[model samples]
Target: MAGGITEMGEPYSPYVGLVYMFNLIVGTGALTMPKAFATAGWAVSLALICILAFMSYMTTTFVIEAMAAANAQLRWKRREQEAVKDSDSSDYSDDEVIVRGRSEPLEARPILSVQRGGSSPDQFDIVERVEMGQMASLFFNKVGVNMFYICLIVYLYGDLAIYAAAVPMSLMEVACGNHSCSAGSVKYNDTDLCWGSVKRKDAYRVFLTIFTLLLGPFTFFNAQKTKYLQILTSVMRWIAFSMMIILALIRIGKGEGQGRPPAASFSGIPNLFGVCVYSFMCQHSLPSLVTPISDKRRVGRLVLADYALILAFYSLLSFTAIFCFAGGDLRDMYTLTFTDSCHALDAAPLRYFLGLFPVFTISTNFPIIAVTLRNNWKSLFHRDGGTYPWVVDRVAFPLITLVPPVVVAFCTHNLESLVGITGAYAGTGIQYIVPASLVLLSRRHLEPALGRGAVNKHRSPFRHTFWVGFVLAWATFCLMFVTANIVLTETKPKN
Candidate 1:
């Protein structure tokens, strides 16, 4: 209300760090991190984390610089204004011309006179403001923004479809266990705790298939209303984090047994890196933090503090997970994996908790993907008159949101595969590539200012180094993961 409503009549509200963090977690981390580590090995995962973090930091700095430049330009122009007094007491005098020329309308006369009077001596202000505004526009408009929107659509729909199918499948597997009609015989490995079903082992495969087919539209619709959806997401994240911690502790205390195989062999270096990346990917929430810290100087400080806290949280969780499941199967790497494998009958509470975590995370994320898609579609077609206005505001939004989940329900009707694919791609783009590119672009454009030491010293070289290195490395990692996923998916035998 304070900021007033826009022409579209929507109220403006500033973003907060918590919201951004929630967005990052639900949109990408919740669904992907577990699977990413599983696929890329810990080392590659860790490399991805470092790269993503660096890129995110860089992007944030650029955003701040861009804002500052624009503001500075405004301030300079405002200061250069020359107050004009009426030379003739009459309102209709030459000095008070209602319209300057035949080509100019009455409304344009004042603005033209102000410029013609040459009231502002500081031309830098105009230049800076123009440049900064253009920069901001570029970030928010342009093909880059469209790319982000498309990426989000792909990620969300893909994930939602997979999860919709995977959840049911995973749940059924856990529920049926030895008594499952599909499972004729159940064999459990000692160290790995891997379970094999002789009959109907492919029961869940149906869900996977359904998930893959419905992924496109489901993700597109889900990405639209990410901003408000984050509130629910935050709660889910904390719950997941808690479940993970408890599961880790339980595994570490009780040795793996009862058909559980040894933890997937950690490629030591790769695993470590993977864990780090998983943790760092959470930092994509940093931008939401920017809006709250109005002062530029304080923004740098806040970012540092935020990163410190993030690192500490990630380190604790990764360490706990690694130590607890030291010799377990990496394929089933989740907070519930330990409980499912070792204490199946006994660890009811942990399993239930873990089960609940995905439900919340997935539900929240589903809406986000839908919202993102709807908004982007509206921006492109509705604004151009290519589509009816009511289509976006009324028909399209609800249809996009509801249709995907329904289709997902018909497909594999599970959440696992949906989460997996969404996590890998959407998570990677939002967390790594977008931020990295923004930083790179900012650095290139603002190089002169940075070189002149015009930026606040405390936020210079160290920050720049982190971002530049981060963008490059993270981009590489994301590309690799995407390629690997495409190759793996394509090469796999079809059911």
Candidate 2:
């Protein structure tokens, strides 16, 4: 019976689950953080990041509580079906009863009474895996669900675009940059010659073409990363992260650090906000990671520890980077900072490895994101029992998923602005608004089934309604700030 509750995947211990959450939160966004930090000033960036981390953690708890609520709702409904079947077999013997001269059906009573009536907290156990989207559907109206998918689709598109540009940009740098370590720390322009006649941008396009040909087809089918590939990528990610941090610290220690960032820069705040939000994003995927934990009684503690570790890691990486490289010299991708011929790193092979790191990692991720986006598109338009045409399912959905991001990548390779905008708007909806709304609505939805006195053992420490409002308000402020910054910056004179 217990196995029947959580059969979606194999469950692991809470400690292993902690590692998975850590890895999920610290990905490509961390690579972009240093640049944002340098531009925004380390002091301001630190303050904003700390605040955002707390807010993100609050929302993370919200999502987890909602998941438990979702699980409880699912279990209660399943039991209701069982009860109905049994009642039908007994010729409706227990279907109704009289309460104070009013007739009531047996199912009308609190179905979750037994579990919640006890002190064991079994009712709110996260025994089932309910995805964010499923929770949205369960707790939101049709309009709200549509809006949720739209925000998610847009965020995924931005992710695809970032991955699309990053790989080719990495390849172009490794292929076109001077290999003898003789260029002496000069940035290349798009029009610069990669070879005899091909421009660097042209080389980027060529690699993009090759990338599309190889990885784009996976979107048309159900594609997943194998366990071995997951391990390989994880190992490479740690190796690359450790190498960059160590190299940066070595340069800073030698008194060769080229950075003297200002204490604050208001202009850089919006992008920094977006980057921080994006970096701390694990809310949407929490259901998958948390539901598989064999013992979830301490899941909240596990989440706190994971967030603390990630916050420390981000601060370390960004601080080392901002101190090691000059603000102007900082590349949008932090890994690119080590690719140049500089005092910090003199080895040509290591330089090339760092230069091409994104190519290896982002390429592996593009297909998975593309497939995810494709599925979201299907889910958005799916009818209750209707199937799509073969052409639409295989061709149209994949084409829509693969083309827009590639085109966006081709039009501009400004990874910083891309991430900033995506994280500010769509990421805001996912990280803040959606979770807050879900938790609030889920509580309301569960009240009828499990009286107002019922408690969700997995409820957030911020179980107060005020915290939900605070998160929503903060999200609103971030969106407005980011949008205004973009407008003012764009309209400012370009002399």
Candidate 3:
């Protein structure tokens, strides 16, 4: 089948999707995992990360299933409209042909389900591109859609905030802080002066201003991260990762390793959960990523394989860092470890390269993410067939997208807390709860029309109702646990 690959020019091979997913799932969040890993204890971090990865994978399948269902929903809705407009041209055979060719067949034959029988022809047929917002409209009630928008908005805002803070923090660390590998173990306070008179906090704020001035305006225009840019980012990411992993391995081989992470630390599990969930996040973009694959009959298997590779990759990357650097020695930004004291490496150029990795990568992504948030804002307020006012479209939307994150970044440059908060709450909603609910409701909405036996070609592996309940329940518990942890930690007396 030609499917929905036409608009995107040439579709990529299945392996390309594998690579795209890996890159998407392993971003800034991975940089923070080692610290959480060290703090939480190696054993806890390892076990928890594995469990979270599995949970995230499960929800990811939920999203893909929902995306296919959404596509079917859109396809049938359009047909309904067409049928109304051309009532006189209706033919009974046309309905059957469309049903047989495009609609979910009356019996579900999941591609991954263990079956000895032949598969249905239309089982893999919902090939239209349906974004999460469009799916919300089709599947969720008004309140549910609004809640989704709000949750997504919060998540996007947190993302932009984290990005806005990260670039400047890296710049400030590079420009004003001590670079002598000797004092790498000591923590620097924000009140410390830079350039003789400028405080480190002030330096961070200055860089944030510069960051906003330079990249913030991209939010005003409609933009897409091109394939070339993605490739470039991916290359840089691998180079940076390889550099750190190799450096750490060399240090450990030389008996110079500083880290002795404990086997398990219960206290550190919460932050690790947030960071891992954030790192594994790719569900929100599933519709865009999955729909354009050249061959998707095995999309579920493809995603499962991707998640497996990603889990192994993350474990390798984080474990290497935690062992190479002491728990207290690891910085929230893992790149800072290489920069703090470059004596570990003799090459000055390589030292600078490691220190500034986040600056380059995060800077590139900041604008792209800002534009995504801006688009989400527009979608939330959007009316059908309605055009936005000049101020609302051009000015207000971009401002809304660009400001909150900047303000949050301005107040603090703590990358760990920012990532933690974003992932724990908004990330939970987007990655877990929303996907589960969407699939459940989509199944319900689709069943009456497609019938009880209808098979969603892309239905989640957890096709049972209990799995949806489990996901939602887990999300709720995480939210409560994270919230309680934050409150207790903040309110406790300092000894």
- Going through the candidates in the order shown, the clash numbers are 62, 0, 3
The residue-level lDDT of candidate 2 at 239 comes to 92
TM-score order of candidates, top first: 2, 3, 1
lDDT of 2 at 253: 89
Between candidates 2 and 3, name the one with more favorable TM-score.
2
Tens-digit lDDT track of model 1 for 1-495: 001111222222233443344345333233334543444444554455555455555555554544444333334334333322332333554444333343333333432133333322232121221222233334445776567656655654564454565454454445434432243334343222223543333444443344434543454333444545556666666776766766566666687422222234342323333333333444233323343333334446555555555554654555455444433333333544533443332445555656556545555555454555565445434343355656556776657755665575564432334444455556566556654555455545433322433442223334555655756575577567556656776799999
Model 3 C-alpha lDDT versus the unseen true structure: 0.79
Window of ten residues with lowest summed lDDT in model 3: 109-118
What lDDT score belongs to each candidate, Candidate 1 first?
0.46, 0.86, 0.79
Off by over 4 Å in 3: 1-9, 89-124, 178-187
In terms of TM-score, how similar is model 3 to the real structure? 0.89
lDDT of 3 at 109: 23
Tell me how far candidate 1 lies from the true structure as C-alpha RMSD in angstroms: 8.7
Residue clash pairs of candidate 3: 108-455, 181-341, 259-326
Estimate the TM-score of every prediction: 0.60, 0.94, 0.89
| Runs off by more than 4 Å, candidate 2 | 1-6, 93-120
**All candidates in order of lDDT, best leading:** 2, 3, 1
